[model samples]
Target chain A: MNNYALSISFIDNKLLLKFSGELSLYSITTLQKQLNTQNILKIKDIQIDLEEVCFIDTATAIFINNLLIKYEKLDIKVSVNLNSKDIKDTLELVKNQKLHSDKLPSPDKESFLYSVGKYIYIYYISLLSFLNFLGNLFTTKIYYLKSIKNIRFKEIAFEINESGVKALPIISLTSFLIGLVVAYQSSYQLKIYGANIFLVDMLGISILRELAPLITAIVIAGRSGSAFTAQIGAMKITEELDAMRTMGFDPYIFLVMPRILALMLVMPILIFVADMMGVLGGMLVASLDLQITPTLFIDRFNEVVAPKHFFIGILKGPFFAFLIATIGIYRGLMVKNDTQSIGFNTTKSVVESIFAVIICDAIFSIVFTNLGI
Target chain B: MDKVIEVKDVKTVFGTRVVHDGLNLCVNRGEIYGLLGPSGCGKTTLLREIVMLQEFHGGSIKILGDELNGISHSKAQKLRREWGVLFQAGALFSSLTIAQNIALPLVEYSDLSQKMINEIVEFKINLVGLKSADANLYPSQISGGMKKKSGLARALAMDPKLLFLDEPTSGLDPISARDFDSLILKLRDLLGLTIVMVSHDLQSIYDTLDRIAIIDNKKIAFEGTLDEVASAKSEFIQTFFSDLK
Candidate 1:
């Protein structure tokens, strides 16, 4: 039902551009390219015709308003002709708000100094907030120790079941699939080199040492981590967190601590289960695809997969869980009292936790390698 | 007075349940009309339908003389500027300061100068009995009653011919509720606005409404002036009055 199209025509010294589509953020690029391809100095005037424009949003309005300012500054007489009352209303809104708005210059229009200053300031503030969050978490833990009876054991158990037990089926499936894929791909190369029996050795070491914990943490970051952010953010939006504070209860102790503790306690168990499933998957593929019997696969797997490698992988679990829970809680707590903020923060929580998990995994590998593990 | 809002044979159905059927209501200029009923009686649903935020199953809602049924995009935007809806939470933009919230509509819908916009923002803020200093505070920084006032100020920003208030006094204290009622009355007198309020506040109903429409058994069981509503012999009306007391 959205019949949108744009066309341009030249008349003497003026360019007549007609917009028929929903002139929104999606169409701004084409609009910008039209301006880019045209030689502004050769054309003295440009008229935007909005007769058939079906809709216009704030982003489009801001873009057009900024474009007009640029044309005006360049001595290009720009005008807008409209028959649609809808376009008039949108432009009217943009015009009224233009004075107080942050004149959106497309990214290329932004000054280098402004970008640098803005990003630096943003990062600095984010770092400070993170430190503050850690400090609050530490003090809350101390407070929980003093009032152990006040701690929400019931909620912690509920969270453990939700984040740990509920995640079992999906985690097992992903781990098995990854292990099968890894074995299938690597066994072919090993077979060509007449090292077919080495399939179990390679799969076992890789899955237990790196893949299992890393993949599980990544999955949990997207699922349970985002859930934490959404739950906490919704609680914040409904003012339940505020209500707790005013009622002489620390939200950190009652709300945040339980979630963080549950995730931290559950991650090792999840990773261990993931390791078993993954190795089993490798054994299945090795026997079926590589002609290695199940007994031979097990013998090689047991001989090559060292306890030190398994220990090193599982040790990263608590750390990954801590980062995921901490990042999630931080993002959720940072959420402003609005739907947009909740959505934005939940997305940011998932992305940042996954990134953090991978980075921490890399650091763990490097430290373990240096320690001769 | 010309009717600003006229709803005829309006019907709303959800799955197997019927929310409204053959419901008709007419509101006149410079008058406050109240809609009252038990919970889930579609009072808010009717308000949403009237505001054009929702579509009815069957009805003709003629707003300010323009029929809302099958209204085009351009016509809808035009109609939107002529009326404002105040949600129960005030629904102020959280990121914007109070003045920015009030100025949003004017900025979006008018060609007024920056100074003029600021002046109008100040005027609206003061009209709602807020200090000009409050103009710089965010919605979160304000109390519930103040948020309602800010919401009202924003609702009045575009100088809408019709104003819709949804549960305006639900979370307010008695003094604040009374103050809100007086403010609504004062605004009606000052601006000649046609107000459509959905409320359960008996004080608000008695203080602000000139006419009341009560819903019962899925239709308007009673409709009349406040005094008429108070003395109506309908069993539902009697219990409403008694239960509220």
Candidate 2:
């Protein structure tokens, strides 16, 4: 197949060649011949229309970079019209890299130290700002309470069912497989000690304390967190937030509260489902590899994993939900009235939500460990 | 004339930038007041302050004789019901159909039955000149002018006594802009509603406004009827008029 197509048109004494498809090593010779036939040497202005081009790898980018350099030397103005912003950004980055290849270097000793120091300073400031925000959140409990009072319970419940219930099957399947893997991995080592029953303790504790919460948080971060960000960010960029305020609606109460409450109520249920699936996954592995009956596996699971473990797992649910929802809304609200800001805040919301969940989980782990629970 | 909105010595700053420095203006009931200025002249900021969306550094703002600061959150929200704002980009929810978009406020604030809500939505859709069939289509599936009309329909759903429009004719063709202007004029005449608009479109301002407030030099440059503004002879006003000549 001819992987590339090139169309050349002369308009207003300008050579406008629209290039579509790929520009590869094989196609480069054909492109060169076509350009030569057009008397490119005499062309004053050459416009490369990349509007239909799909992919351009490093080699093709380099070839184009060289062509641009050669055209500049021949006193021909070269312009490119690209379809996708990603492609345009890649080309710009490639051009910059080519132009500044010699000047670029790994950071020196002092510069590295300075960079580390700067990062440290930024991290410290961000942490302080987060703490301050949390402090404000607590101090203004009345504001939160008032906002909470305005939440539409029916609407929030519907949204919870939509976001949470619909995601159950996949979450359950994945966690079940995770549990099975953990059980299978533990059985081999436990068999060596003739203490295979300890596999239950290991699998149960790990899933309840760490794996379930972490997996659920990650899932929700990608699922509900991104949705919250996109919804709020879009609203922000479109001035719907402003419209809500203008229409005698408190945006925080109408928008943020509903989502927050929905997530808060739904997360615990999701976590419980995840834990059950994880145990079932362990049961599957136990039944298959260790020749243990399902009933025996359940009894073992019950014996080793205490009620506190379940409580601890459940306790982390609301905190994780709060972290995800709060960060999503906060980052979304930070969006400026621009498309770039909206995208930036959407990505920021997902990353920040996941990061906050993990950090909060670690704190909970530390506190639980210290309390000897 | 009864003042619907009054801003006295209002100042709004964004970090280090002073967007509105001691700005003051007034809009009378049943009058269409246009805030006219170049881009980034704090017209949007002024609108936000009037709507109680932005906090003023130092000033007293009274909406329908209620002190802006003293008004409770619910009271402010109730006051907001008095005005409908059509944002620059229409701000329609992409996921919602035109009918649902129009019905949002009514569903949220009113205790109307679904049949009543549907009727109201249909009435609004027709009021903005959109067909009943157009109600099922999402915002992204429609044209820009249609989206603006849908937004206006939603804004009008609350049957507001006051209306605020920000760049209502922006990004629209001349024909669409004219149609929108005519619609605004018709709404005002029919409903006897007060309108506060921020726009740089001179034609829209002249065609619809009872009086125009020109913002320049961090304050109101002039506030009067269009003819009076035209005769002011200030350099800014003169240049502005000459540009359209």
lDDT of each: 0.85, 0.84
For residue A48, give model 2's deviation from the true position in Å: 34
DockQ score for candidate 2: 0.71
TM-score of each: 0.48, 0.77
Where in model 1 is the C-alpha error above 4 Å? A1-110, B1-245
Residue-wise C-alpha lDDT for candidate 1, range B1-245, written one tens digit per residue: 78988989999998799999999888888889999999999998898888765689997999988998888756776777777678788767665799987886676557899999999999999999999988999888999999989888887888888898999999999999999999999989999898999999988888899998988777898888988876788888899878877
Poorly placed runs, candidate 2 (over 4 Å): A1-149
Predicted model with the maximum DockQ: 2
C-alpha lDDT of residue A287 in model 2: 81
User: Model 1, range A1-373, lDDT digits (tens) per residue?
Assistant: 3365668888887888788867778778777887688677877889988778878888888887887888899898889988878778887888788776785677666699989998999999999999999999997788687866757788799999999999999999999999999998998899899999888878878998899999999999999999989888877776445423322245687669999999999999999999999988888888898888888878777787788878887998999999999999999999887999999999999999999999998898888889888
- Model 2, B13-52: lDDT tens digits are 8879888777888999999899987678899888888888
**True interface contacts reproduced by each model, as a fraction?**
0.00, 0.97
